[model samples]
Target: MCDQYRKSYRLGRRPGEQGPRPLSRNQDRVEKLATGTATTTTTKTKPTTDSSTANATTTNSSTANPSITILTTNPTTANSRKTNSTTVNPATVKAKDSSTTTKTITDPGRAKTRKPNQTTTNLTTANSATANSATTNSTTTNSVIVKTRDSVTTNTTGTSTRPARITNKSTITITKVPKCKTQKLKITKNTLTVGTWNVRTLWAAGKLDLLRHEMNRYRYDIIGISEVRWTGKREIPRGDFIWSGENSNHIRGVGILLSTKAKKSLMSYNPINSRIIMARFNATPFNVTIIHAYAPTSDSSEDDIETFYNCVEEAIEKVPKKDVIIITGDWNAKVGTDNTGWESVMGRYGYGSRNERGERLLEFAAEHNLFICNTRFQQTSNRKWTWESPDGIHKNMIDLVIVQKRWKTSVTNCRTFQGADISSDHSLVLCNIKLKLKNKPRHNQRYDVSQLKDQTTRQSYQARIEDNLKNIHSTCNLNEHAAQIEKAVKEALQATVTLEKTSKKSWIFDQTLDLTDKKRKAKQIKHLSADSIKEYKNLCNKVKNRHDRTKKSGYKINVKKLKKDYKLATAEKRTVW
Candidate 1:
C-alpha cells in the first residue's frame, strides 16, 4: 500500500557564540480511519525547557512499513532551565506540552531530538524505521542509573518487540555524529547471508541453464552477480536490474544482480559506467550501499580493463565512500603475485601490496579500511579456470567480496558455496556475518553523569575508575612480560615451525661448520614498571641450547631438518655455519 510523508529541517547558528537549536518531534497521529476520512500530518515544535519533553511518535495499521518524517532547525536562544530535585524518579516524561500518544519502548532509548518545533510519523511498516535527528554541543545530557533486574523478555503472544532505548539529552550543538552509531537498527532475523559471486558469463555454462534453480537453492538475503553480459545499448537482459553495472562481453557488458530481499530497501541509485554499480540500501543497518564490480583480468591488455578500473574508482567516489559498502562480484585480478598492478591500486588507501588478485584484493581492502571475508581456511588456489574448455586446461580463481574494515572483527562463519557451482562455471561464495554487538554495562559508560556528579560520588566513582585505569596500566606493563615470554616460547616453537635436528648424511659429514655469529642487538627499552630482562636472557639461553644440541657429535640428524637446512642453504644470507 502507498503512504504519504511530510518533514521539516533547519540549520542555523545560535546567538552569543552559543550552540544552535535543533528540535525533532514525531507524532504517529491517526484519527481513526473513520468512514468519513483520515489523513497524516507533521506537527511543528521548538526548543523545550526540558529535554525529556521532546519525543517521536510513530503509528501504523499493523507491524509493516509506515510513512515517516524528520525535522531539524538551526539554533535559537537556548533558555537553560535548572531545577533541583534531590530525589529523582527513573520514570521518563515527554518534552513539550503535546501528548503524542504512541507505543514507546519502556527502555529509555528515547532521545530529545535536535530539530525545533518539528514532528514526524508514518503508517508504512514495510521498511525499516529510520526516522532520526541530532544536534551537537546541546546543553542536554542523559544520565542512566542501573538497577538489577532479571528475565527481560516478555513471553506474551502477538506482541511487538522493541529495542532497549537509552536516554540522551538534546542540546544546541552542531557536531556531525554518524546516525548509524546513534540509532538502533532492528534485526529482522537471526542472520542475513550477503554474498558476491562472479558468474563468468551468463551464457557460458552447459550446466548454467539451471541458473534459476541454483539461485533459489540457498536462503540468501542479498547477492551480487558480476559479469552479466549483453550487447551494448541493448535492453537490460534481467528485469530485476535494480542497479546495473558495467557492460562487457567483447570487454564491457558485465553488470550486477540483487535479490528481491535487497531490492526492497533501495533508496538512491547510481550506475558507475558499464562495469560498476552503486545503490544506497535502507533499513535495520542504517544507510549502506552495494558496489558491484569486476576488476580487470591480468591477462587483458592493461588498457582493455581501464574503463572498468575507472568505473570502480568512480563508484568509490560517487557513493559516500565513508559509508559501509559491500563491494562484491568477479574481480579477475589476482594478488599475492609480483605483477605490481594490484599494488598500484591498493596504494591509494594507505598500506598494502601484493600480487595475487586475492592478496592484492586483501591489500586494497586494507588500504581503503575494508576487510576481506575469505579466511585461509576458505581460501583456495586461483588455478582451475571457472570458465573451462572442453579439455579443461585453463583455470583461475577470481571472484570475491570485501567488507568494511570495522566489521571484520565481528563477522563469523564465512564460507563458500562451492556446491552451487555445479551449474555455473564459478562457485557461489557465501558467508553468514554475525555482528557481536557489544552490550556495554550502563554504569561503565564514559559519559555517565553519575561518575561526575559531586565530590562524594565522584570520589567513589574515581576510586573505581582509577582501579580500572590501573588495571589497564598493569596490563600494559605485562605486555613486555608477555612479549618476553613470547620470544622465549617462539624460540621453542621455532623448533617446530621448521626442523631443528641436524642431518647425519655420512656422505657429507665434511660439510663445513662455521659460526653464524647471527648478530641481533636487542633494542632494550628501559622501564622500571616493565618486567625484568631475565626472561629475554632465558630466551637467549634456549637458542644457545638448541645451537649446542644441533652441533653435537654422533647426533643422528632428523630428516625433516635436512630438508629445512637444504632450503635454508639456498638462502644466500642464511647458511649452516
Candidate 2:
C-alpha cells in the first residue's frame, strides 16, 4: 500500500542515523508508546501540543535488519498544518476480528521491535463505521505515530464534537440455606463429683464457701446435696438447677441437683414418702437421674427397701434404651435387705445379715446394669462417705450416686470440693462434664494452621482470639450451665421437631418394649441377698432352738402356701395381704 504524509512535524527528535545533528529541545514528557500505531486525542479541558508547529512531511523508512523496517522523519523541518486546539468526537470502540494475529508496539520509535507476545487490537473509531477498526498494540516499548489522513482532515476545519462520558459500574448480593450433617454425636465422657453432707443449712455451713469457691474454680454441671435443708417453700438457689427426692410422706428434707446445662434431658420425678425426690435429666447423649433420697431411719424394713429399688427401676424403664441413666441417694440402712432375698446397700448399720437392706440396694443396682460412681473416682470407699458423726465414729456415706450401663463415659472429673467444714457438716463437690456438643467449631471461619509456621504468627492469632474473648465478658452468673446447655440441646431437638412438622413419618409413635418399670417395684415385698440368706437361716435355727416357746413358723408357711393355692384355684381376686 502506498503511504503519504500530508502536513506533519516531529516536536521531539529521533536518533541520528549518520545525520547532521539531532535536536532534543521538544522533549518535556514522552507520550504513550504504541506499536506502529497512534490516535489523535486530547483531553476536553487540556491541550497537549501547539497546532502551528506542524512541520514538512518527510518519510524515509529503511530496514537494516531482515525482520523489521524503520520509518524516518526529519525533525528540523516545518510545514503548514496548524490544528492542536481542535476537539474530536468520541465513541465506544468494538473489536473487528478474533482470528488473525497482529503485531503490537508500546512506543512508536521502537515500533519495528515487535514483541512475540503482543496482541494488536483493532477498535472502531467514530470516523470509521466498521466494527473495531482502530488498532493498538499492547507491547510496552517505544512507539511511532503513523499520522493518518484523518489527522490532516481535522486540521482543515474545527468541526469535531465532544465524546461520550465513560461511566463505571458494580453490584453485591447475599443468600442463606439450611443444611444437614451426616454423623451423629456420641457421649465420649461422663464424670460426677458429688457430695452429700448434713450441712445444717446451705448458708450456715462455712463449707458452702469452700464448696462454692471450688465449684467456681472447677466446672461442675451436676451435684447432689443431701440435707440441703430446703424448705420447698424457698426457690432453688440456682436457676439452672432442678431438685428431686427428699423426706417423703414427710416435709422437705434432702434432694439432688441436676445440671440443666451439663445433662442430657430430665424426664420425671418420684417424690415418695413425700420427702425422697428423684428427677432424671439428659446430658450429652445420655439420660441421668439425680436422687435426693432420705430413707427414714424409723422404717428400715425389707419391704421399704425393696420399694426404693422398684421405684428406681421404674424410672429407668421410662428412659430410652439407647440413653444411659444414673441415680444418687442416701439409704438409711447399712447392709440391709427386703422381704424377697437380696442384698441392697453397702455398710453395716448395727444390722446383722438376718436383714440385709444395704446389700439388697447394691444387688438391685448390679442386676439392673448400674455402677457406683464413687468406685471410679475415690481411692478409698471411706473417703467418699458423707456426714460424719460429731464423734467422727459414725462416718459413712449412705449418700451415693450410681450410673446405669455404659453411662460411665458421660461422667468426668468427679471429686468432693468439701464435705465436713461447711455449716451443715456436708462438704461441697465439684467436677467437669463433656457434653456431646453440636458443631463445636465455627461453621463460617476457615482454619489454616499452615500459616502459623513461626511463633510470631501463632502468637498474633492467639492474641486476636484472647482479645475477642475478653471483649465478650459474660454477665451470666452461676454458669447458667444447665439452662444454656438445655438451649443448645433444645435447638437440636427443635430442629428435629420441625422435621416432624414437615413430614408425615415418625419412628417414636410405634416403638414398644416389654419392660414394665412400675411392676418391677414392690415396696411391700422384702428382697434378699447373701447376708439376708444367712440371717434367714439363723432365724430358722433360732426358731428351732425355741420351738417349745415359739408358734410353728414352718406351719405358718404351710398355711400361707395353702391360702395362695386356694385363691388361684377359685380364680378369686386376691391381694397378697
- The TM-score leader among the candidates is 1
lDDT string, candidate 1, 62-110, tens digits: 2111111111221121125221211111122222212222222222223
Best by lDDT: 1
Separate clash counts for every candidate: 72, 100
Point out where model 2 deviates above 4 Å: 1-214, 231-238, 244-252, 258-260, 263-273, 333-355, 376-382, 409-420, 426-577
Q: What is the lDDT of candidate 1?
A: 0.41
* Root-mean-square deviation (CA) per prediction: 30.6, 33.8
| Full-model lDDT for every candidate | 0.41, 0.37
